[model samples]
Target: MAGTAPGAITVALVDDYDVVVVGVATMLEPYRDRVVVAELDTNEPVKDVVDIALYDSFAQPESDHHEVKTLIDNPHARRVVMYTANFHPDLVAMAQDLGVDGYLSKALNARELVEALESVHAGERVISTPPSKTFANSGDWPGRSEGLTHRESEILALITQGKSNAEVVALTYLKPNTVKSYIRGLYRKIDVESRTQAVLWGVRHGFLPDHRRIDHWRGGP
Candidate 1:
């Protein structure tokens, strides 16, 4: 990868959902001078040579998945960072073993997130502290407008992907009962009463993963 401009670290935000990347992009807008979002890719490869490729693990597989390795091997991304709410010790270790430059928590505020990216760009391996259960979620997800919390939205997204309760437990590392509770909560918020109804509502409300990329910053042509 080529060098970035002085005083700015170029970034490629990666996720499977358009809303996920867009939310992170919006959060970084105020700090554009320090972090230039060079690309916003949804289920697409990072085509530009950027200082950092920040992979948001929203409604997607965790760092243990092959997706993380793909980002690490991408010649276009000088460094790859895992930006996720999951900080399981095993997952962090897996990401480190996969050669991720950083493992950041989603609880970080905008300023802290930018600083962490800067640290990674400076060739440091960074890992954030686990967030308290009371910490508010930082970025957006698919069903936030309809009152779904990040976890609830994730459950719905996985459900839309046809994951059973047990599968959700495995993928999210959540207890089976917790997954059931989230599903129940999301069902009420979305005005659905059954799994079929929730899936229908999720499909209509953008729960599916996207398949394109935004090469420019913030809608530039």
Candidate 2:
């Protein structure tokens, strides 16, 4: 569950296996009064009041894409737990990037799954592996250059919105080559390697306005 309020949370389980479904239902029997398993299939829309959701990684790619889209689109779908038989490192990283609350191996017993749910409900990230240690010791880099020109800042803002080079050029009315030059300058000013990383840093340091506010970029006549 995502929220701390016991009465506020509704859980959904989306999986293809009946055995797995039975195991999860058995584990959640204690909280059956509070937790409602909507269904075993991914055909239905995830309810807004649902604070937590679980998905079987073995689900078809189309189902997985839709599930991720649903969770990302729904602001209320804050915590998601993905259970899979395959614990491949790349798959785990992909799950983390999608902002899942927990990634547990399906081979684990119901007790472990229950514990993961409990921890995730408590607002803790319940993933099985530890987060990267490099970030644990890394200090914030003094990378921002106050001397960035206005146009450079504008380019950075567009990049943060995840606009591609061609899109940025169209948005700014700049030539493609000019856009690439601006991006190079942005990377140097921000001390980043790629446009995506530069954009992330810009957003993190408040150099870029919230991407949702892009309409503000078009000035009134």
Candidate 3:
């Protein structure tokens, strides 16, 4: 991360919500000399064009990524830097697969954020999640959905081990609705759209526990 530092990396701030837009804009104000920031409208394409588009997640866990996808799909933003809290490795992987130039954290201070921007602008693929954090319930769960809550991770393990929602409920002694909620949360956290994907992701991330012995699991998702 070494550069002579330009006047500023021209950046267009894009976030669906107003408070998020304002909050990020204010955060960048202190770095005014390092980065020139301009806001983008929620509906219209970017009016104040820039060198890169900094899209904020505004602490949406891994939720509401469709908005980020929309930003990536449109051609208005030259380089799409995900200024987000969705730092799960799996989620970050999906973002990279979606062709996000840089994956950053909303929790970062102004200096770290600015450095990330500069690195990203210099043609780097920056996905900042701790690659080692997995679904295993180690004591040091860092943040939301990145490693998942203990129960959610355990449920994800069972789901990957081929447990149905009902079976998971029984295994965890949680109600069916609770199991379903955890399932949905797991899916959203890992950014998987379906059972098969979630299973594969679990396997890929070593998230399996032990499989429950059932004659046969009922019903398919």
Candidate 4:
């Protein structure tokens, strides 16, 4: 459902950790109509050459000149943005010195993130998140049921993406039992005893069944 507008920004979420990559991809799913989150990365140049490439620092530990330079050299990523959790001033400056178009932290919420990307797309240098928050965290998403909790909505979102319990654990970075427990609670709250039923409910409420989104890390060139 990525955008088709002629001026729509094409971007790639590049991270070594598959789970981080998937998590970011999931976070951006609702904005498909505004930006094209291109499926990229391969031996060949990525098919949908992107306007920006968001390099998650979890995948890249260091902000060295050569590291940023390599990303800048990627043909598919015309502009490089160090999308990371690290905000140490020295590291940020080092990255910027290496021609990174934007140095964005993972602390920004989804709305702030899209705004930063849009600003970057418009040729602006965005380097800070809103003053209030210092880390990326999920919202208290209310579910369709009156008693459903935020964690339930989170689990429901993952389930609707066609993720198995194991995949959900990987994406959420949660323990196996913890994920199962959340699933069990969500199942009860959603009034669904089976995965299929839960998925159906999610679909009815606007969550698309994504059988292949799990492979988004491998989707690039």
Candidate 5:
């Protein structure tokens, strides 16, 4: 987390959405002098001494599963945030059990994302949620999906559509806060740490169309 002074914290963004990557990078640009985003992938490997490894929990879970485990296992990668959209309660619990720094949803706003990244990088956990007034019912997501609930599937679907947390909030008509909770749940069930992975996982698992055709945030084509 807070290894040194307020200087560039190495960040790795692992999502499949060019829009998300571009949006996140733009928001982080102001802190470029203090924060450096190394590589952006749907998988892992921005091999340097990275303080924060931010990735999509939904990204190719099978393929990146071992890679993510390896990344988290590395002591050098001190901070880990599972940024994702589609997941189940069990997945979020797993992330907590794994002791990841935090979880983020692409559906979250730029401000929320920056706060989460900064907080995680500083050794704090940032949980993103929409306005409290958005939803009237809060289901016990923990037990909703015996294996993979309908809501979990919906969250994943929105992620593949390139919708931000805010966008998903508006689309689902659920309270922004509820959507955020859904994202958290998804991470635990899928055993991932970020949204980039979520999108990738969707593609790999046939939930989302393969978007490798899009450009990556770190100059990927």
Candidate 6:
């Protein structure tokens, strides 16, 4: 691997939603001098060599999944960082055991986020302080325009992927009743009376994961 430009750590922002990664890229814009965002990938592999591959867990699997391992195994990514709101003790321990360089909280401000990346790049393990409540919704997701919260949209996305409520509970670590509540709320927002209808609505909308990459050097996609 090649060294990054002096005084700037090359980074790749990875997520399943364009708006999610784009939002993170926009947040890091001011610190371009310290952190050069080389790529914004949506459900795609990182194509460029970078100091850090910041995997944003936005409506995607948590850090314990194979996705994190994929990033870690990529030769182009010098280090892998999990940028997620899920800070359960088991999840944190699992990420650390999986050899992630950093486990960051989405509640971090831009400056804090940059500093954590820098620390990881400098050969130190880092983890941010977990938020008291759920992390605030910062970026976009499917059904946001239809009054669905991020969590609800996440549930609907899983449903659109053909995951049953039990599977959703397993994947999301949400209580069974909580999952049901989200499904009910999601159905109400989309005006669907049945799961099949909700799935159809999600399919018509943008619940599916995207497959594209945005290169910052040549300008974003």
Off by over 4 Å in 3: 1-6, 41-44, 59-64, 130-221
lDDT of 2 by residue, 1-221 (tens): 33334453466654433433555666665665556554422333333445676765422232234555455455545677776544546666767777778877554555555666778878998766533222211111122245555456556655665767877665454679988987888788768897668867866765432221111111211
Model 1 lDDT at residue 143: 88
Q: Which run of 10 residues does model 5 get worst, by summed lDDT?
A: 134-143
Model 1 Cα lDDT, one tens digit per residue, 43-144? 344446888888888777783467777777667789999998887788888888999999999999999999999999999999999877633557788988
Candidate 4 — which residues are off by over 4 angstroms? 1-6, 41-45, 129-221
TM-score of each: 0.88, 0.46, 0.52, 0.57, 0.49, 0.84
lDDT of 5 by residue, 162-189 (tens): 7788877654445788988988887778
Can you write out model 6's per-residue Cα lDDT over 1-221, one digit (the tens) per residue?
24435779988887777767777888888888898877544344445678898888766677346777777777778999998777778888888999999999877878888899999999999988886665445555677778888788888988998989988887777789999999998888899999999989988998877743323222334
Q: Which stretches of candidate 1 lie over 4 Å from their true place?
A: 1-5, 40-46, 133-137, 212-221
lDDT of 6: 0.78
Across 1-221, the per-residue lDDT of candidate 3 in tens digits comes to: 12314667877765433434555667777787787775433334344446777765432223435655666666655688876543555567777878889888655667777888988888997766543333232121112347576567657766777878877755455678888888898888889999999889977775542211110111111
Residue pairs in candidate 3 whose N, alpha carbon or C atoms collide under 3 angstroms = none
In order, the Cα lDDT scores of the candidates are: 0.81, 0.55, 0.61, 0.65, 0.58, 0.78
Tens-place lDDT digits, model 4, residues 52-90: 888765423353445556667767577888776556567
Give the top-scoring candidate (lDDT): 1
Candidate RMSDs in order: 4.4, 17.9, 14.9, 9.2, 12.6, 4.7
Model 1: lDDT to the true structure: 0.81
Better of 2 and 3 by TM-score: 3
Task: Order the numbered candidates by lDDT, best leading.
Answer: 1, 6, 4, 3, 5, 2
Weakest 10 consecutive residues, lDDT, candidate 3?
212-221
Lowest summed lDDT across 10 adjacent residues in model 4 is found at 209-218
| Clash statistics: count for each candidate | 0, 0, 0, 5, 42, 0
**Which ranges of candidate 5 are over 4 A from the true structure?**
1-6, 16-20, 40-46, 62-67, 130-221
